[model samples]
Target chain A: PDPALDDAIRAVIDGKTKPLGALGRIETLAARLARLQGTTAPRMERCTLTIFAADHGIAAEGVSAFPQEVTVQMALNFLAGGAAANVFARTLGVQLRVVDAGMAEPVDHPALVQRRMGPGTANSAVAPAMSPETLAEALASGRALGADGDADACAFGEMGIANTSAATLVIHKLSGLPIATLTGRGTGLDDAGLSAKRAVLERAAARTGALPPEAALAEYGGFEIAMMAGAMIGAAQARRAVIVDGFIATAAAMAAQAIAPGCEAAFVFAHRSDEAGHAAALEHLGARPLLDLNLRLGEGTGALLAWPLLRAAAAMMTDMASFESAGVAGKT
Target chain B: PDPALDDAIRAVIDGKTKPLGALGRIETLAARLARLQGTTAPRMERCTLTIFAADHGIAAEGVSAFPQEVTVQMALNFLAGGAAANVFARTLGVQLRVVDAGMAEPVDHPALVQRRMGPGTANSAVAPAMSPETLAEALASGRALGADGDADACAFGEMGIANTSAATLVIHKLSGLPIATLTGRGTGLDDAGLSAKRAVLERAAARTGALPPEAALAEYGGFEIAMMAGAMIGAAQARRAVIVDGFIATAAAMAAQAIAPGCEAAFVFAHRSDEAGHAAALEHLGARPLLDLNLRLGEGTGALLAWPLLRAAAAMMTDMASFESAGVAGKT
Candidate 1:
């Protein structure tokens, strides 16, 4: 932890707000921000949510029961405010922008921000799917959105069929873990399907000479994941708290961490999911998940569920009657 | 479920404000209320949180590491707004009222409602300590608070040291399950402590004759538990949603359900807890917990943590754009 940032955070906690450390994680995050900015009472206005929609090359391999077209449908659904994610964003009173970073179809929804790198990447099993230029474009798009949102806090969520397989490959390559350990039934695949998915990921991992972390992501990463990694870095550079959701978001966080070490300071693990690799990914990042519901429904649902706790934490920081304010004797 | 209440609930779900069946649980709760009250578009304006603070007789048996005095201290902590529950209630803008139905000390906080049934009960190992009169008073106090809040929704939470042992006994007797299966280390008790706790509860159950259902509660139940049960029944009578918390609260729900079969329609399990017996209690009530965070931290932390999801469900019911509204085609 940066000492200056730590001090700033401590000051916010110690401020004449609520009780000291009353707002558990929210206070912790706010204080950390105060320290990062070397100020007390750091403001957290202008929250932004970046919804990255992509199609997984691995989807063609039958990992998910839903066809790859469902990804495009859901992405369009997101833009149309019909999906669970859209409802959550609206309820949270947060600004939501949908990005079609790698959709196979030309997303016609007016609400969607068309930043397509291509009509989706080539199948990961065959070769390095996304090219260097596409990866760079995805990253640039993420940064551009962060700047555009002028977000004081930002979160990244993705919508794509079989993206978990793409995330599994990303995690295996980045964490240097074997495919079997990291891979599981992505979106309800059975034993045989899981085994086939693992084999495909292993083949993809080996094709790129265990492509050095950053290069590996550019090689095997989904357009959404790489772009989200960029968004994480951009949010951090802008001094915003980056709330991360389950497996795929963690993979993006890892990529972001690799690219910009300082970004870790801005990240908070929202929840531990039922997904097999989520725990390992959380452990690797030394992040404590806020909730541990067996939720595999991604689209930042887990994060949205955890939002009230965050607000409570902030409220505790701002409203709790501290030892001094209440004139209560502290632990002797 | 009442046929009238069921029809009322369906009407709310089919209201012109949103698409059919899009609001999910919120719509379900509203529709259930419609049937219960014979109206549609039921509103949940006034929300109440009845926090029951007590001292467990089991605490005298050295079941918990924290001294029994800590219960009073924490109860005071709650009234002083220094506890996690206080911050949560404040953030949700919900009214919180603490009831000292079984506290050993004369609760000093002016904010607390003095509904003390007794100073405290005797050790359950000796007998089914609380007399019928005291249990009745506690139950009435809870019911009165529920009515007074005029709440559209009500939630039950507790603040008592070593109360988990009391809850365990309630679970075992209510579910007719083995004490060992239901017992857990309450508030971080170790293996030895747990074994001793289990033995005490088993003995208490045998001594009490394990009274039948609701009647059993008067024999072995704490003031807080009994009061919460009354509150649940009162909320049901008011046609409000009763958001049930973990073990102890679920025990109250069970008692309420036994006394008033119609109350089951009003209850919503907030989360599947890490507590050993919580799942069994929820299953017995045919309730589905909204979140499953493996969290056993009592004091309504889990339920309060889940409030956002509940609000989101309501928001989705009220805010989501239908296919027609968004000009998007619905999936066939």
Candidate 2:
């Protein structure tokens, strides 16, 4: 980000006809967008939400509340325009894309982007989630997908049973936070189910120690998570704003930030999730999301919901009249 | 609002293809719209943002940051589509209406609605802010304006100089909160300005121990505030959802609720403002706003920014598929 450009944007925002700083966080958001685009006025006219769907082998350990088949079902739901993501995307006029990264049984829809790395990742509780070759393929495929879109911003979502467990272990290894603190109810888990999931994640964490980011992904990350990380990096390379969804998408962003340290400059976190460990994860990244509606459903729904605020901020920069232009008196 | 219909809406929301309560506040918002409209599916397709502009008598006490003439200037700004409210209303497809409730100087724009009771109100710190006849005229005029729109939802905004002072005293009288606690820097006041404002409001509060709602409005309310209160009640009576804006608008809502006890059922608080005592005012009404962007720019901008979320919620009710229809398995 250019400090000079940021100062210029701030000056313009301050000259608006409202009280100094009365626009509040919206002023801050406008400045951030301007600095990212290196322009006085930025536009968020077109946005695309990419939902990466995969199955987690960790589901074999009974980690998620729903069975693994739900992943493919949701992928099909997205293609059929029947999911929450589809509804929100339609409401906001956002383009929606669903990708099948690696499901146990692939959905055969013409609209589904097939970028499968394997049937699914191996269960991390007993072994590494994926081979290094599979990890490389996933990252490369996601980079291509992210680079192909012409939208000004790209939002990422994930659909995988037991993926929250995968995200928790990945984050625990990356940040060294406690396993119990980072684990939570995935899709409405009962107390016993939550405890059991935490115990299983502990077993997965015990299998490795102090691994690099790549090794961490190969060991603990699901196919969709690794791909989303690479997609985020690629989107940043293309200079598009990376709008990260809820907790699982945050895990992908954490991985992306680790792999490409400067790519997080493109990230605009959408909301703080009700999921356990989300707040800690956000704190670790020094990120504050735009909305906090206790949203935990994650098919890029939260990211799509925040799209209007970005538009409003950009419009404020481009459309609002300055005090002098509006012939209004300034503060005494 | 029907209790049985609310239960039916809740059931419909739960049966959507996501987990129970996964959509967070959105689920609650959908149910609220449904209950308010007395339907399982409510639509927010058309919305109107009515900005009531007036000059507050409190400005004579030096309680505001700007001169009272800014009110007429902003009303012209709104008519010219150069203000933040105009931009947001355009972006959200909401109709924008500018009402000259009782500005000291009337704007000559062809689109301006002239509902002037007088050439402004009297100074409230020394005497009554408005005559009883003026208050009654303002309410009736606002009621007619609110009931005349063909919109599913109505949002209220105020653009009156020193109106925050008027709202502070009005809320203090109605809510019985301490005047000092309810006073704040309206539009970027320095510490000394804030102290001066608080002292003036305390003096106004001491003018009457405990007045009836109408008497208090005549003694301390602005024409814009009285009009907005009447507008909210009229919109509720017309079965249109009422979206209340920041500090001044909340004070109007408080008065509206006091005037008609059940009118608040149609109210949807838009955002928590950065202004002081806004949280206390919201608490007094038992309200939790949909957004919290620290926005203090009134002109209905905060309410307009929140319009997309309401649309998404309504779309979720009308569009999203149930698990049975999508053939997705339930939680195991």
Candidate 3:
């Protein structure tokens, strides 16, 4: 970040018709946008939300409430415009794309972007999630795809069954937080199911010690998550804002920040999720997302909801008249 | 609100292609819209934001940071599409209207609606803010205007200099809260200025003890605030949603709730403001606003920022497909 440019943007924001800092986080958001684009006046008119679908081998361990086939079913739901993400995408006028990173079963659709690494990864309780070669390919594929997009910002959503289980283990390994504390009901697990999830995640987390970002991904990450992290880095490299969704997407953001140190400058966290581990993850990253509607739905819905605030912030910077221009008297 | 309709809406929301209660407050918001509209599928496509601009007599005691001339100036700015409210309204596609409730100076603009109750209220620090007749007319005018609007929802914004002091006194009288607790720096008061504002508000609040809604409004209220309260009631009576803005607007909502006991069914608290007393006032009303971005600007910007969430919530109820229709599996 450019300190001088930041000062200049603050000065510009202070001159707006509203009181100093009256716009609250919006003023800060505008400044961040200006700094990210390296301009006093930045535009964030176009946005795209990509839902990366995959399956987790840990689903066999009964971590999530939904069946493994739900991933493919939901991906098809996205294509059919029947899912919450699809409704939000249509409502917000955000371009929606479904990327098949790797589903457990083969599915063919004309609109699905095929970037499969494999059917899925090996069950992490017994072995690493993906091969080293698969990890590198997933990262490269995500990077190329993210960098090639034309939209000014990219919002990421994931639909991998039991992915929250995978995210919890990744978070535990990266942040060194206790595994049981970071684990929660992925969909709607009963008390007994939650206990089982905690047990499974504990066993999975015990297999890893402190490791690099790539190594951690090979151990416990989902194909969708690794790609999301890579995509965030790629988008940041291309100067596009990366709008991170709920828990799983935030895990991707944490991985992205670990792999590419400065890419967080391009991230705008969408909302605080109701998931058990999300708050800790956000706090670890020092992020204060825009919305906190208790949303735990990880389909870019929260990100999509926050998109207009970004537009409003940009409009406040680019369109609102300064006090002098509005011919309004300033403070006495 | 009908309990049966609420149950039916909850059942419908639960059937959507996400885990139960995953949308969190959004599900509550959607249920509210549906309940208010008396339908399982409620539509909130069109919204209008009306800014009631007036001068507050308490401004004469130097209770606010901005000069009283700002009331007229900001109203003109709104008409010129140069204010934050105008920009937000334009960006969110909400129709923006400026009403001269009782500006100290007459502003003759073709687009500005004149609902003048007089030049302004008397200095509430030592006298009743408005005549009983003026309060009645303001309330009636607001009711007619709010009832006549074509939009599905009406958002209220205010631009009366020193109005926060007036609102503080009103809240203290209505809610029986301590004066100092409900007073804050209006616009942008320095330490000494805030102290002085509190003293003035304390004196104003002391001039009347436990007055009724209309009596309290006459004793310590702005024309803009009184009109806003009436507008809220009028909108609620018409089965239109009332989106209440921050501190001052919320004070109006409180007054409206007092006057028409059940009108809160149509009320949607838009956001919590950064103002010191706003949280107490919101708490007093049992309101949980949608956004909490530390905003204190009062020109309906907070309300405007939250408009999309209402739209999104309504869309979730009306547009999103259920799990059965989407052919997605539910919880195990």
Candidate 4:
């Protein structure tokens, strides 16, 4: 990653009139920005937050509290600029794009990206989520529009009713972590609902075993999730920062990393969310998120919230005067 | 807090097209802002960051890595917008006001507040740092200019070479925590230097047992730290949000809370820093900081990083469309 600029970047960051490493993760993020764009004066003020929307077949398992219809409705909400991610994007001046990977119901908004894989995947408790052909189609749909701009970074988010169940099975297969460790109330389920969900997911995990990343996507991944994973791989290929939202989004990142291997170098885990399995996912990925506020929202809201920090990091590196310039004594 | 509006605020927040607490601490902060300003449209775009600069007597005890002269030098650096805090303030668009409380040497800056308490405090290990008279004067100096005008919020920070030692002793006397529990490397001290610092502080603590908050300030407070505590009191009195920096700033906040009793109602602990004694101080205060990046730079840099979150919170509350407005179904 530009070993020549490494010392220069450190000099710029260290020369800022603060204690060494005092700005903490800001400095880390700053260094990454410099490396990603291969410039100390990197700019990330323009961001594109793409929310991939689809429904999971596992909704039939009664795993999620919300109806599958909420997926289509939320995509419409995002297009209408009324969702949490919409507000956050507006606040951070990010452009929001809601891509329809596959929804049980069709969305009519012109703003919705028309890349439908299917109405929804098959119930993974009984059959695989999708055919390998559809999985590749979803992945290709995301890759086609990768970093299609001069924007500094791109964030990935997903919406699928019962998607958490799909993610649980995906991670279990990927990491060999126990299904019991992976299950959580997706959109607020009660004790009975949670138990019922666990039972259904446990059966799915036993049936699927530990499939490869591609096979696992066909087995348990939602179309929206597969699309997001593809989008991340593409963003990293284009050398743009990939911002992962909460649990479901992070699950997409895990899948992307499995396929692309080094895509995580461009990633920024936005928050250590309180979504049940998120901590485990973060731990397995060896990630330290930008914020940890017990957030469970799934629309890249956390990433939008963290967008300002990127600006701060870039500003500190580029706009801030060095010790040599400011005539401030170096830390001794 | 508006007990009557509590339900209303929740309805508004929960109605805002996000999940229940999906925004996490952002929602919590928004609710507080709404309650404090008595409006959902809380404004924090205009911020005044006041950094109090002074010298610590404990520097003579080999408690810090940097020499005392660095304190005044850093103040000049801050005025020139060369310090980390200056960079952060510029990034956040917050106006910075450097208040020279008591630097060992005078600074010539047109923007600096000329309320000098003294050249420096006495070596409190042998005698009191400041007289009760000077302590009162420092407090009055901060209170008199409490939220000088139109500024929405205030952040208090300090620049003293060995202020962490002063803060440790101050917290020890205020909370009766052990010297061992309270002491830490101020800037960057070696193992021998740390041990020597602990020995000197232990003797000082044994010699002067329990002290009231005022007496603690008179004994061990750096003029910058005392001024910061006073500024916090003033900010709270002005009903402006008090953006607290790292360890030294949090120590000042503890002192302010002890004196004013309920000023914390308007407080926002900026970050859980990586300083040795910060966590203990945070635990004693029961504060949940907005950010944590292993920051120990004591120039209000962390506080500036958090300013956007406040803005994001307010924006979500005011600009976001409710479920009804967005025609999205509520949780049922």
The candidates' interface RMSDs, in order, read 6.6, 0.8, 0.8, 1.9
Question: Candidate 4 on A250-304: residue-level lDDT in tens?
Answer: 8788988999998888998889887788888889989999998777878888888
Report candidate 3's interface RMSD in Å: 0.8
TM-score of each model's B chain? 0.89, 0.98, 0.98, 0.97
lDDT of 3 at A64: 86
lDDT at position B17, candidate 4:
68
C-alpha lDDT of candidate 1 relative to the true structure: 0.71
Give the CA lDDT, 0 to 100, for residue B47 in model 3: 94
DockQ score of each predicted structure, in the order shown: 0.21, 0.85, 0.84, 0.59
Rate residue A51 of model 2 by lDDT. Answer: 92
TM-score of each: 0.76, 0.99, 0.99, 0.96
Give residue B63's error in model 4 in angstroms.
Answer: 2.1
lDDT of 1 by residue, B1-332 (tens): 46765654454345322223323354554454445545543444456677888876767777774567766776776777766677778777667777888789886667888888777777776776587777777778777776665666677788777777777777777778778887876566668877888787777778866477656776667778888899888888877778888888888888888877777877778877776777877777678787665656567765676666555655554555444554443322
Per-candidate total of colliding backbone pairs: 11, 0, 0, 0
Overall lDDT per candidate, in order of appearance: 0.71, 0.89, 0.90, 0.84
| lDDT per residue (tens digit) for residues B21-110 in model 4 | 777788999898777777767776678789899987778887887778888888888888777788778767888888899989988889
Q: Candidate 2 clashing pairs?
A: none
lDDT of the structure predicted as candidate 3: 0.90
Which tens-of-lDDT digit does each residue in A199-316 have in candidate 2? Answer: 8999889988898898899999999999999999999888788899998999899989998899888899999999998989999999999899999998889999988888888889
Q: Tell me the fnat of candidate 3.
A: 0.79
